[model samples]
Target: MKKPQRSTAIFLLILSALLLVAMATFFYLKTQRQSAKTSPTKPALTVSTAALEQSLLPQRLSANGAIWPWQEAVIGSEAGGLRLTEVRVNVGDQVRKGQILATFAIESVQAEVAQAQASLAEAQANALDAAGNAEKARSLQRSGALSEQQINQFQTAEKTASARMLSARAMLEVQQVKLKQTRLLAPDDGVISARNATLGAVVGAGSELFRMIRGGRLEWRAEVTSSELSRIKTGMSVNLLAANGLPIKGKVRMIAPTVDPQTRLALVYVDLPLQAGAPNDPAAIRAGMFASGEFEMGKTMGLTAAQQSVLVRDGFSYVYTLGEDGHARQLKVQTGRRFGERIEIREGLAPGAVLVTSGAGFLNDGDLVRVVNPPMPPTASTAANPVPTKPQP
Candidate 1:
């Protein structure tokens, strides 16, 4: 009987311990459930949105190219084997037509001219004497006083002297032409772009000494793909982003006849506006600068949105549109030419659909979002309200 009582007491102690542990576990689980119910969730993200609208936008084709002179004139020496004595013009010099650009050594040419003149004078005197002798020979020809052989010899001498005079006169004219060639003159009014002529340097004929941009005219040669070439035509307007990040206006002058075999691109010539206003105007565009521009093809109606609203991912374009559930829905869109801060939407978006404009980059498909209204700027009346002059001491 004592052993049975001891076992019963031990069993009661074990049961009581188990019961206490079960109650403790139940209370702990209850507390956890209550805490989960009371805790707050993440707040929705605020974003700016806009409604897509259809509007008339200009159709444009974009291309990149380098600015170049319309015509580059090569200035060179016309006389060979002459030492350059003076180089009057330098690179970047503005020169007029017929302006002397350089001078060659004229001392040797002057000496040749003098020699030619002396020879010509001697020939004239000899020719005069020969004419008198020929006249005497003709007078004696009818008389027997002069033999036939002697008359023939005198006539031949006269002809020989006359021919020598003619040769000397031709030599003198040749020397005069050489003297004039010792100076290099500008062929047209232009700005010098390059110069290689050096003082005292002997240059050959036809060697380039300077390069000029004719009439200070610059042109933009935009290269476009072969397929886009047909859409562009002469007389279309163009707007280019210049080297200095300023806009330049131009017009399409011509289209290339053939396309490049390697790049499959054709050249579109655009004539840039001439520099106007102050010479130091910050808007001056220069040659050899790489610029990007757009050709205005025409106008058409297209759905448009802010540039930031469109996102590019994996070579595809998308826009996050707002839905009735206050969530963003990622919709793929086909984009076209961009104008200013707005871009054209060719497809996948309908007019009057609300789109996330500001924070679309951070949102994902079906992500919760809160549309935030833009803050109104302070008015002049509010700005003029002073705080009662702060009751100064």
Candidate 2:
């Protein structure tokens, strides 16, 4: 009985001590919860801020079009029914005016010319004999050596022979022209764009043999909307890029007087310079290549922001500005032409707005932010379009 009484007292004391320790732990946890609730929030990102700048930015109109020849010259054979004997030039060959491009078998033409020449020579001989006989008859007009009727006949024969000789000489000239036509000649200075002449094949007159870009000159026909047409003018500077990404500078040569009814687009003709190399230089832009370009419509005053500050999301332009409470507030902006390091802010932003110039992508709306001074700008030679940035805080 004495041992049982002592064990029960020890168990009761242990339970009371455990209860006190549980109460103390509950109070300590409550105090820690309160302290956590009162603690200050940490900044989510650190970014450089910039004031909205008003600058003179270039007004540009973007357009797309195709490059074409100023004029394409078609070269063909003028003489008919001749076998192609030789092809001197293929497509893309640079040729000067009157350059021989192809030749036909001259055997038939030469034979005909030889026949005509023989005929002409025979006519000349007959004419000389007739003239001599007529002169002799005239000299003997009063002499009894010739009858009057015979003398008249001789005179008439001389006139007929002379006329026949003239006819034969004209026929010879015709044959000579046909003989020269056996060779195909380039009509202009240009680069051959196509060739259709085939060796050993008989072709007729006026059959196209080759196509050339006359003068190696190319023009870009840019399509612009009707509203945008007013902004483009003759002599305005244009910067163009070919499909191969080569940059070319051009000037507006002409603008169409009317727009296409179906597309409501007008053509602006831009003349490209003679590329400084071979006409068919692989590096040079050629006719029929599509291109994109911008027209410099001069300068206009507008609000601008650092190019890096503009963010694009879901095809919408956005920028983050600092709020009075030191939190990031996102604002959608309308972006216009980009010039160098600045982008035109057409709308959705007011002047004097402080924009997060860097690391806005890592931020969320209402997230605390810390602003810092921008680092020194990199030199042009070593700089990229948009400087690399990172969140600092």
Candidate 3:
């Protein structure tokens, strides 16, 4: 009985030991599996990156404007209460300085001039008679044949006749001036932009007859914000887009001293060339035509990146900056003018920063990325098939 009991105890102990070994093996395998699942794997995305560099970029200011004449001449009538007899020039007619534009009725003015001439003739005859009488009176005064008062009266009569003759001559000169004014002449060489004078219409003095574009020159009036007005100066080159979609070159002529109260903008006057190149080629630009243009302020050193490196999201521009830990950090940036394939980085980016050039759109902030140097393509023979290895004996 004692031997059987001892064997039973030994078997129980051996079974307990085996159970402990099995439990330990199970827990070890479970821990190994949990650790394998928790460990992270490297990102699978391959991306290209570029280093930001400082480059000389052109600074430009853009604005919308209207084309206008450099100097608009308001041609009006100088003669009052005159009936227009002939309208020679109409709108769009090219005229020279002092060229006759219109004509007024000259019959009444010619009659007045004739009447003045007759009055002057009568006055001159009277003056001649007075001179002879005065000379006789002087001679009689010395001969004691005339009293002093009578001689004085003769001298006074001669003076009065001479004054009347002078007045009549002045009246004739006045009438001649009126006759010359019967024709309206262009003040300068220009193209007629507007005309209001009509045949048989009675026009008053200072009434507008025609509007001329002096020298046939046009200008671009650009409206710029108050902040940008200071950067513009005279002689700056501007590029204006014409209505015909052709680019017209212009130079800054003047800048308005005061800003418009309502729009809070200032006007920049740019002079357009009279002729683009040909004599017969009409000016491509016209007044009152809306234009869009840019002012080339100058060039400056700026940090720029390729257009692909930058991404726009959430109404803000962003770029993926390569991090030292093999990850991409999303950064916000302020952008400026764009030139060709590159964009100006105005703010939020530093020089010498590595930026992701490709696959930036698929990245998030602090996203792991695999940097890749693209491999060259294989040769045609290599791409066709692999060379079989020799069998070693």
**Which is the leading candidate under TM-score?**
2
Per-candidate TM-scores read 0.70, 0.77, 0.72
Encode model 3's per-residue lDDT on 1-393: one tens digit a residue: 899999999999999999999999999999999988898657847898887878788888999988878889998988899999999998778899999999999999999999999999999999999989999999888789999999998899899999999999999999999999998999999999999888999999999989998999988899999998989989999988877686888899999999999999999999888874222466466677888999999998888998999999989999998777788889999998787888988899878888898898888888889988566688899879967899999
Q: How far in Å is the alpha carbon of 392 misplaced in model 3?
A: 36
lDDT of 1 by residue, 144-246 (tens): 7888888888888888889999999999999999898898999998888899999989999899999998888889999999888889989999999977787
Order of the predicted models by lDDT, top scorer first: 2, 3, 1
Pairs in clash, predicted candidate 1: none
Q: Against the correct fold, how does model 1 do in TM-score? A: 0.70
User: What lDDT score belongs to each candidate, Candidate 1 first?
Assistant: 0.88, 0.90, 0.89
Clashing pairs in 3: none
Better of 1 and 2 by lDDT: 2
- Which has the greatest lDDT? 2
Q: Per-residue error at 370 for model 1, in Å? A: 7.1
Candidate 3 local distance difference test against the native: 0.89
Worst 10 residues of 2 by lDDT: 274-283
